[model samples]
Target: MVRNTLQMIAAGCGVLFVAGGAIASPAEVTVANAERRLEAGADISMTRWHVDAELILVLEKEASRKVTAYLQSRGRLRVVDVSVSINMDDRVILADFGPGFLPGPDEAEVFLHELAVTLRHYAEQAGLPIVGVDFRYQGKPLKSYYPAELAVPPRARIDARNQTALVSASHGLVRVHPALNWDYQRPDAFGFREDMITPPYGDALQRLLEERSGSGVNRARNRSQDPHPESNRPWDYMSSRYHLKTLLPDRTDIWNSLPNDTDADREVKEDIRARPLYANHLGVGTMISLHTNGHELGAIRGVEVYYHGDKPDDRPLAESVLCGMRELIRAQPGYENFPARQDASPGGHGENRIGTMPSVLVEIAYHSNAEDSVALQDPVFREASMKGVEKGVRLFREGKTCEPFVLQQIPDISLAAGTSQEITLPFAGHPQFPVTMEFTTANCSSPGACRPSKTTFDDPNTPITVLMRCRGSLTGDARWSVVLRDVDGVATAPVEFQHTCSKPGGSPAA
Candidate 1:
């Protein structure tokens, strides 16, 4: 796989040389020189800063090719392309993977780790002074994973009965790393770490396999009920067994878990445990826990934003984020029907009860449904979803309310078969700026359809017209539920329209 990746990188180098213009001397390739060229109206695309253009081109080309090849080898063909850039000020290398690179939560985590390692090795070989690697998928920025720092030996142990990995590093209190508790459920497995199932780990078994000779599936079977007898340290076990390393001490935290004894007991314990961390980390702005929902009914879909009910300060932030996600989803194509909203009830989960700061746990669409899974995989959808949360954060920080955006229901319309009827629906919000709302029909007796005359509402107070149409040979009493959504894909209460279609000779009635 490495040889093939290298060969592909070599192939890409040929293309880069042919397309990349003439290379400049090292003296002329400084950051100052690049800035001067930019000031003189040189195309930004044609300039390279603080590095030789040809070398940068070669490195980027090779990195892109190798990353794509690496993902392909892991049975992922979603990554069509990759682009790498360097930030001179931060001394960080950023790699942006094109759409479809990450199909699921599991893939996203793995791709980042693998890509980081690959880029780090290449950067080291090229004598580049990069301090960290930042990643983006489909234009949406993701968390940065820095190289682990060398730490003096820390005391660590495994609680077999509790299925927790306890690490008592010198800098902080004892941190409990729960095993296989991704959904905050009681641990059932022995070998899996909480991080392994949560964000950043990707597929822990796959990572372990990458370091070992055998297949990941086969190696995972050797899950020991306890940590290696020889290595009492958690970090040691993680490195030697799963090839995993810790992020910076400041960035790391013990996974929060509530005892399953009782609701009151769990809440009291969670408060006591979380308050200290919150108080100490006063600089921490907010917290977001990522999760996906599973339901017996496969039809459940859309994004749910949850905030602590007890924390009134977090309500606005949660609402803002919810609005942002809804608007983003609505603005994006193919996600018009995707619903994003604040959960009606405040979240009572242990993670949400972190009292020190505003916290939100986003269930990024339902993973139970087939359609939602496909939507989740789409890079555009994923990017918009994340941007919504970010926009919410920005708004919250700026003390701006996200309540300006609103959608209103249009009156029901009855239309004849093979015919169309137009009706106007009035909505009010953000009067000065244009707002776009997508009109869609769902839960129809037949396949009811509706199209808005103008999706963009330039004048907020004015009514927008929608053309409701029905087509199909056989039709009786048809009930069509119209969902009106704003740019963020947040829908107003759906308005049900009743339409009656008679035979061609018979008159249509409402």
Candidate 2:
């Protein structure tokens, strides 16, 4: 391997000569091997170096390591093809991802974003001068880029004088003339539709936003409420005092229709475009479109938040919302292990894309799944979700990102003696890869009985698999923990896992 370094700091940049071979496999491109060669006193900005096919291959593998691993685990999603290119003098790197790349999910954005970050980081580590990065799918440039779009911190229109918010339930009343509601429905399996569920959620969200902003405001608004007589009608009732601009089409806005009376799908399409327009008309700087997700696969259940993929400003709001929702939803008694499926991703929903300001659409829980359907009906769950939305909006305004990596709750395992099972521990994060992870086992029957695939690896983007073996008919429960430390040496709270070893033919624990 050639370790190229730039000695000509005052001269022009060095370019990479194309050298070709088979593309490096992902396993061969672990972060542990991407070591920086610069001296301790070296300046990162001044450093520049050459690149080649080998370097580009490794960079592409590492850049895609996270999303690829995640999709592989789920048994879905694929990257048709990908290639990386760099402009050293301009300090810009562009990655062209072929078809099946975006796939209309927010994880695609995260994947592209993470890939861009990793590409730049690897190049910088290789002593190359890189300042910005972008990604393209099928030859067309993506709307956002790293470092540049993120330069402006996201601040919602929350002023001390009169703060305002836009909380829209995904589907509302289409009962009136020329109106339409085309929400994802499963009327046979589930009683209430997405339309039925989201309105109350919007109401709760509006109330929570008011309560969180200031309960005193609610008290002062009682006088205003008296005159208005709080009916199912459109007015600036919330904006008048509570400063919450909630759009619950289910209740207040029933007569929402275009003069060109049309079918359900067209009406709904127009409605999707109209909501954000209404928000823009009111000068609302932020929007959260609440919704319940459904899938043909009823097993798919979890929180899924989304933002406009093209609009870089939208992601912080989505991520903050996911973090907040995860924080509270996981705290629920029976819902501790619920996943934030792909966390937040760009779903190309018009609700998010049509908005001018920072906007996010949250598929809070899946309505098609039995477990999630029950959760949507639970008041405790709804309250936690609403509170989380409020917190997310607040956090976004404060420019707070989520914890870089969070290990999802790993369930206890039961195995027959003399048997081994490989358990993949999934995670969610605002990923910045090339970080280190360390695992510690406690109360193991023997040293090699329980082992991680990699004890000390330098990546947290993918799931970690732990091999558990019940050596010599060992019968007992054991515990293990993980200490995730980033490059800066900041460690998160240790996450623990429990597993039980049962005798060969005996029944496992209940």
| Cα-based TM-score, every candidate | 0.33, 0.44
* Highest-lDDT candidate: 2
lDDT of 2 by residue, 1-510 (tens): 122221121122333222143343333332222222121223434434355555576656554555566567657667455677887655567777766555332234324543554565456444454545766766765444333422332444544343466777655432222432222322434777775577677777778777655421111011122333233323322221111222334422322424354443343434455566555555565777887876544655678787765666677788888877876676567766666632356544555665666778888897878999999999988987887787777667656665545677778778887788987766655333444556677767655666653354445445666677776766777787876554323345678878788877777632
Q: How do the residues 415-502 of candidate 1 rate in per-residue lDDT, one tens digit apiece?
A: 5567767777655443223555554444444443333323676664566666655566555565555445554444555566665665
Highest-scoring model, TM-score:
2
Model 2, runs deviating above 4 Å: 1-162, 175-189, 215-264, 403-510
Backbone clashes in each candidate structure, one number apiece?
A: 6, 4
| TM-score: model 2 vs. ground truth | 0.44
